[model samples]
Target: MGGLTQFGQGLILAAGLASSAVNTHAETAPIEAHAVFSPQIVSGSDALRHVAYELVLDNFYDSTGVLQLTGIDIFAAPSTKPLAHIGGSGLAAALPPGVELSADNSLSIKAGGHAVILIWLALPRDIAVPRVLSHRLEFKTQTGAVQTVDGVPVRIDTTPPIIIGPPVRGGLWFADEGPGNAQSHHWGGLIADNGQLTIPQRYAIDLFGLDAKGHAVAAPIDKLAQSRLTDWAGFDSEVLAVADGVVRDFQDGVPTHDPLAPQAPTNDLTPTSLYGNYVILEIAPNIFVHYAHLNTGSVAVKIGDRVKRGEILGHLGDTGQAGAPHLHIHLSNSVNFAGSEGLPFQIDAFNLVGRGTEGEALNAESDMHLSPGKGKPVHDAMPLNGDILEF
Candidate 1:
């Protein structure tokens, strides 16, 4: 999802898969296939520039185990000439039943009647430009079982991403520190009680665009500001679920360290080392909402469990990838963090404090509050807190 380009022409490649048997009988077990398209660049004429994308396919199931893949097709429109095929190596393999691949090329074999087929695709350069490229994978199986899994159609954009309602309505507080103090800073995104992206930073980071550095430029902190240690833990925070979703993935129990702390001696470490306390919510088909930086032992959900929007999944604290205590939320296409692509979203309504009077809302174009300070005006703007705001 991250690699798609605006030029229309592109390539589709097969990644790999993870398989499992749902039923005791090998013949009746479901075939869960996962595929990944590693990052690649496409180069054509002067009019076209090299653009890269990463494609991931997860848990595509063939219940009857009847179909074997034949080939994959990608449909795309080019800017210049009609593009034909891509160039790159692909990966495919059989996975052990129920053991999903944690990363590309890493497979866990399990004892079960079911086998998995994994595919990886790499695109070639010199493809035509300005054409719509759609991927259609062909498969054949002995059982000819009908595929019953969800498939996301390729996206060509026109409709801007939408934020559902208001930010979660609750007491908003900032951990107090004197102005210009960097040691006690915090950061968080605003969400509605229903768990939609409503805070201005969400869109600014996800949509308004990125800077030359490729990081979310809309973040409240500049490079200098982010570098300040005191800015990390200045705000108190809590974890709120953005939508009704299943807890598909999680990690916890990692120790919190200062961002300025020295690195560990050994790179190989626990899952907690990287994620701290984290949760991945399957909000929609191939769409997952990720929450990170939770307090240790604060996770309220477990793998395979269900949660409602605005439910207390965990408490906010300094954890993985954090400078201080705050909630980091993002929508993605895959449960695996590295395999997923961020999706833009919006929240309904909330007062844009610091820009005008209280009870005002902010929109994509509105100038809203950015950082902690006093005497800021609150404006009537889009609601980002937990109140349901109608678009």
Candidate 2:
């Protein structure tokens, strides 16, 4: 009887093992990832086509504590090889502001907390654009086990980018803080307003004029910090309409700030205070073009006025939140600056003349010289970060 009992226990254990093995539904990891918006392939000043988007990672488990992300590998759908493998410092650098990696260089998402990763993937012009992208995330669990979540897929947006003429007239304009890195305030900007998060300046460009010698100001380098608004090279440059559109909205009467004085207080600033004197034009149905930081009283058109492309809208200046004189322009779906989403648009034509960074261009010690471009005549392409172009 005892021998029969032992055999019966063995049979029961085997049956239980079979039941577990046959179970088809099993959780892979405690974390989940999805794209905030489908990435679109857009042309930059460089030879590569850039795909810029954000991924949201959620630690949905209630009892899982903290899940640390170690690596993220992005792949074209159905491919074993990854297009980009981000790990170590690369992974840490991609985290949005206020989110820092742990001492071990792993990004931590607490239980029920979420994190965002900005992916700026550049594909060679010769390579075919992928129709879909898949991601594999490697994470270290609270229990010291390493797990991977694979096959998180997001479709690629192949829609052609919006095309328009230049917002500023002929001169060498440097695209400062343009689309490129995740560290830039504009590209990395994730605004949380009214319980909703959005990036309104994702594709916006802060344009500063460069003289023949690539200097950003009319004043001498040693005198730039103390110079007035009139001393800036881009000051009083005519801001043009990019397309035939009626004025949707605008802000006026906000006086330009004193450069030597402290910056304007950032707290409790309304849209008018943030953008200063500005204009928004309805270029298309649901597509609006925004020009910000215009000089006070420089606005030429009022709301509801229909304007033609290349029409002078206003003059650029150091107004509102602008630290210095520069034209801030972007395409959006709404007239509200912080509430709208930025759309990527290209210029009809421009001569690529040089390249330099904002730091190099703004340094007051010496003239900010730019590396000479081949003077390549570009048609319908977005000027990239640090690109110096003559429109």
Candidate 3:
């Protein structure tokens, strides 16, 4: 392995983790698993950064008899003793039922099935990550007999993508770490298969701003109480292109949904509704940038239009499946909206303002929410959960 090297203006280093792998096994157990994992995890301070990855298990059994996946045993490379045993039932506390760490990590060829398992291994800061991650699993039959399954291996990379930071300067923003913790609500699972790889939203992120007091919004205590677009900090805020790119595709005309307002019964969200009024930029040859939930009639660019970094693209709004006015953004390998694989990115520069949960960021006093983070300014680092980053 070569030594780490800095790339571009960002302090980020690319940990030769460009190599990826996939394996399938069905010999020992009736349930067959196929999976992929990123070999690299960005380093951080006291907290442990996770190496995100995914697993797909095809339960080859009928509905009459379902197999319950009990738990996963995590192990570091070159060591035999397990490091952590995360239970599926325990995962339900944090995630929706059915995926990895659900009520029962089980399988049955039936109406509702959890197609993939999205997971991340805890990586400590500055520590030499293991070369390969060994995950051993077990499944149970209805009769209570437990059958251990083969281990799923994932590589660990200590580097991250050498991408730049917020396209706009002096902007207030923070990453919402809650929504995508499980299977990343963005690129969660096998959305579309292009034969070479299975694309999952392993690194999708939502960006929002803080109120004058540092809260996500200054709304009423009631969850359903109305908060005008102007009342929220980021509403109508300019959405900038993150990099020099050409507008490959775009969407608009969808009316902005009123926040906290009761509405007549309607159909659930569709692809268009989920990402109301959006834009896609081909920043690189293979990488595409997606900006979702823009205010209706606020898009300034059009398809095929060449755009530079920090260029005005649109204004943030409460549209689609959004609860409030905020910006939803992510990088993908393909131009397919919510159908392609997600990619990780880094920012050029951003100030750490505060750190807290969604509830804490809302309930806490403004003085504390806007308080300076103890850590120094960050360059080329992936935003972790509960991080309130200011640009």
lDDT of each: 0.36, 0.74, 0.59
TM-score, one value per model:
0.38, 0.86, 0.76
Tens-digit lDDT track for model 1 on 1-391?
0110111111112232222222222232233433222222222111122222223333234343334333333344322121222212222222211323334233222322322222122233344332223443333234443232222233333333434322222433221110111111110122232333222122111111111111111224323224433343222244666677799888767765543344443232222444568887887777677666666777778999987777777765556655444455555566654323445454433322221211111112223344332223322222221121111
lDDT of 3 by residue, 1-391 (tens): 0000111111111222112122233224466665654645643321345565666666665552656665556667666656555553333322322433333444333323434555655654445667777766666656666665656777665545648447444555656632235523443434444344445345655676766566666765454246667766677888888889999878888788676544343343233545778888999887888788888999899999999999999988776656667777777677774346667776667777666555544443435436544445876667754567777
Candidate 1 segments whose C-alpha is farther than 4 A from its true place: 1-155, 159-236, 258-260, 263-273, 354-391
Per-residue C-alpha lDDT of model 2 across residues 1-391, encoded as one tens digit per residue: 0000000000000001011111123236777788877767888877667788888889997788888887777777886666777766677667664567898889988899988988777764455899998887888877777777878898998888889999998877877767765656675677777776678777888898877667676655456568887766788899999999999888878888755445546754245767788999999988888888898899999999999999999998777777788898878777776667778888889988877666556554445444444467898788887788887
RMSD list, candidates in order:
17.2, 14.3, 8.7
Cα displacement (angstroms), candidate 3, residue 159, comes to: 8.6
**Candidate 1 weakest lDDT stretch, 10 residues:** 178-187
lDDT for model 2 comes to: 0.74
The TM-score that candidate 1 achieves is 0.38
Sorted on lDDT, best first, the list reads: 2, 3, 1
Better candidate number, 2 or 3, judged by lDDT: 2
Model 3 CA deviation exceeding 4 Å by range: 1-28, 36-40, 43-49, 76-83, 88-90, 93-115, 125-131, 155-162, 177-180, 187-200, 261-273, 362-369, 372-375
